[model samples]
Target: MKQKKSSQSIRWIIEVFLFIVAIVIFFGGLNHFWMRPVNSDLSKGNSQSRLTQKKFNYVAIGDSLTEGVGDRTAQGGFVPLLAHNIDDSYDVQVKSQNFGVSGNTSTQIYKRVTTDNKIQEAIKKADLITITVGGNDVMKVIRTQLANLSEKSFQAPAKAYQKQITDLFDYIRQYNPNVKVYVVGIYNPFYLNFPDIKQMQDVIDNWNNATKATVDKQKKMYFVPINDLLYQGLDGNEGVTEKTETSHTITNNALFEEDHFHPNNIGYQVMSDAITKAYKEHVNEK
Candidate 1:
């Protein structure tokens, strides 16, 4: 009886060991066959290096707008669309790299151009450079003040705005003297007003005018007035309505992200179209 009991105990141990071994193999196979590839694809989708190849002809530099804040598709931001459009329109093999970071202002970009090795290299190789900045600088300050007071109380700092704009232009010229610079004007975000929002629109107009002046002063630079493109009636007779928000205006949502400032997918496409059109015009003029 004792010998039989010992033999049964040994068999039970073997069975338990086999069960654990089978579980390990099952999970290992699942990961290798299924989960691994999904993870790899996601990583590739978010990879920044994939945006531009070495020595691209066109380069986009600025804040979240340039980074494709509004685009939901992972295929890439407007930079890719701009590149493809340029190729089709100009019949030139144009490649583009986007060096945009969320919440970055002109000051940040100025520092980046000098200190960031990757950006420096991209600027050196690029024949065309597009920028969308100064919006964040103005918006951030306005939002902070508006949080506690009425919209009428909001006033933009003229001196600070001038300095930032000047510094950004100076930095770009100092970095690459020959590269064509296209400065994008700020889009109107207060079309659908909460309260005291019209003042925000006025501030945006001033900021855009400053940007235009700088571009006008430079020989190789041009200002792409996206504000005019997105907002209907450049005569300032009407503001963007909620009905036209999806196609023409930016909204306060995740599509626009938490900031309620950046463009969603639709917004990014509009920007891409404007830049592509400008590039085509420039090529034609040449």
Candidate 2:
């Protein structure tokens, strides 16, 4: 009876050991076949490096301006121009991706950056990023209050626009904290067309000011003021102010395309010049 009891005890110990070994193998196989591949794909999707080995990566985002809506060049708008210049001046190859959706509001742009996996990946890899938002946000308010325009009318939209701007930067930083961001200030496209509406000028200025303040607080971000570059002095506001004077003639109806809303090729050239100048100056300082 004693021998039989000892034999049974030894068999029970072997069964317990086998159970533990089976558990370990099951988890190991699950990780190797399922979990590891999922993790690897996520890393590749978010990788900042572009194919074919470029020296610099640029990501441009914003509204119609970003889309180069008025640009006659089939080659995209100011982004391509800026990319070319950067390549020549810096003597480095640049891979550029423009994620501009025509007529996009700040809120829409926020959604795109957060949800669009392709855009998120491009932004993550960007060495330099340029954003031109808030224009459509301003336009939305202007359209609503066209007849009943007032300084007070702008206050509400400005507040809302600020919130969207805050959210935009937040999303960008979440993806890539170290990339340089240049927030292109909104130009008064309506200044020449609707000069009599003095409140419009005030609205544009307020929007630019809000953007400047927001960008000032963050490192590796800058506010590129194109207001002065595009300002042609409408409705007796001011003829021209030489903030950062450019040689290009920005005024004249020819600068605007047929729509009278977007800039023509020459006008886009002026914008490209302003952005490139700002970039060069800022980079030199560093």
Candidate 3:
């Protein structure tokens, strides 16, 4: 009888040990699957800005877009908006300096980045640097080639722009090798008025592509494309990408009414949001 009681107790203890092991294995598997980190591709879709939890110095250097040309709010265009966005998203203070020239060309921007002392100091201090160039460079070519406009007309200029960017970025890296640099691309504000001229958009595409390619060749450099993003109406409706020559006059709701060239306040918001998305998606731990 005593021998039978000992056997029963031993069996009960073994059963309890197995149950505990099973429970631990089940929870361990659940934790592994639930807490797995994703590190492959953060560049595809919208990603919530990770909490940086630190202060950063932001430097804005580019063209009219950087100058807040058409912003009715009188605030510095995307620079301030982006500062505010980063401040909110990362829970850190953003001290931004705007070095955007109203109509600076790529060559002009290169000159400043290479020679200007103030911009050099800013670049040295910047944790994030955003560049808005190439739009005026594209416009320069368009103005000179409007009479005989074709895709080939932009080839040489595009190459020159690419070289300038390469050299410009090279110079920037010489001083601030590790600072993250984001370059904003050009867009076709004329697409609405001249839908028949497919080559017009082609020229713009060529410039943007050249700029993106140049940026791709460098480390810690990124391109923020705004061409297609600006094609949508402020109402979230599709803008006229496919317009016939006979199509009625379509206005880009995001563009400023006064100039129909620069982005309005809402347009600046769009730019800032796009910047935030790209920054969050590609930002590495620092």
Candidate 4:
């Protein structure tokens, strides 16, 4: 009886070990497939400085959207285009440095503002600092909640979002008080609606308003409503249809990268135009 009991106990231990191995294999595979890309992007952005120090007139900073996820043109990105356009139009020697990275959120920018030596130098020297952030934060939340909750259910996180925005702006202001800061708001990606697109739109709108409120509290800080420029009706304006020549509307071919989140070439052009317009206005103010 003792030997039989021992054999049974050994068999049970083997089964438990096999079960644990199977669970690990299942979860490991899931992480490898689902989480790898996100992890890779985060790692790449957090690693090092890709931007060259050329003493640019303008510096663009933020996440993947600002990193030129779209745009097939090989001439760097929209920052170069905007600089060249400004140069050609205003007859000024305009140079730009792009400090954007893929998959960064406001938190990352906040960290970069505090830690990045190159960014600190650029901020001190730059005449214009245009930034596009907060999208990744909102996107990450949406992606996480989409599995179980309705898009509208994501609205409850507004307070947390506001805190992040406030913290990000506070960090930027603490770093450079006099720098011309333009905070681009988040734009809606789910315009076509697989789920509650309207709720997502509302969430983004509230986020933008929160950003604007932060900008309003600071001197020399401006909130550029790029989301409105892209998503027209969100601000009570007529929606731009395909007939509209505005660069805001994404052509089917110019979709973002594999993540289906960032902008393509056409989208980048729209963003460049918005930045150009804001910069021109800023210059005129001075």
Top candidate on lDDT is 3
- The residue pairs in collision within model 1 are 70-263, 70-264, 70-265, 254-257
- lDDT (Cα, 0-100) at 53 in candidate 2: 37
Clash count list over all predictions: 4, 1, 0, 3
RMSD of each: 21.2, 26.4, 26.9, 14.8
For each candidate, the alpha-carbon lDDT, in order, equals: 0.60, 0.68, 0.73, 0.60
State every prediction's TM-score relative to the real structure. Answer: 0.66, 0.72, 0.76, 0.67
- Candidate 1: tens digits of C-alpha lDDT, residues 1-286: 9899556545433443443354345434432211110001111222365455333377778776776655666434566776766655544556666777756777787787778887777777778888888777765554454333323332445456667767776766776878877888887654433322444566677777876886788767788887655554333434333545455443433224433344566556667788777766775443
For candidate 3, the 10 contiguous residues with the lowest summed lDDT are 33-42
Give one digit per residue, the lDDT tens place, for model 3 in 1-286: 9999566545543443443354345434432221111111112122343333455788888877887777776557888888877777766656788887666798988988788898898888888889999878876775566445456778999998898888999988988999998999888776454444455576777778878888999988999998877867577664634448775666778887655567888889899999989999877745
Indicate the residue-level lDDT of 58 in model 4: 69
Candidate 4 at residue 211, lDDT? 73
Q: Please, what's the RMSD in Å of model 1?
A: 21.2
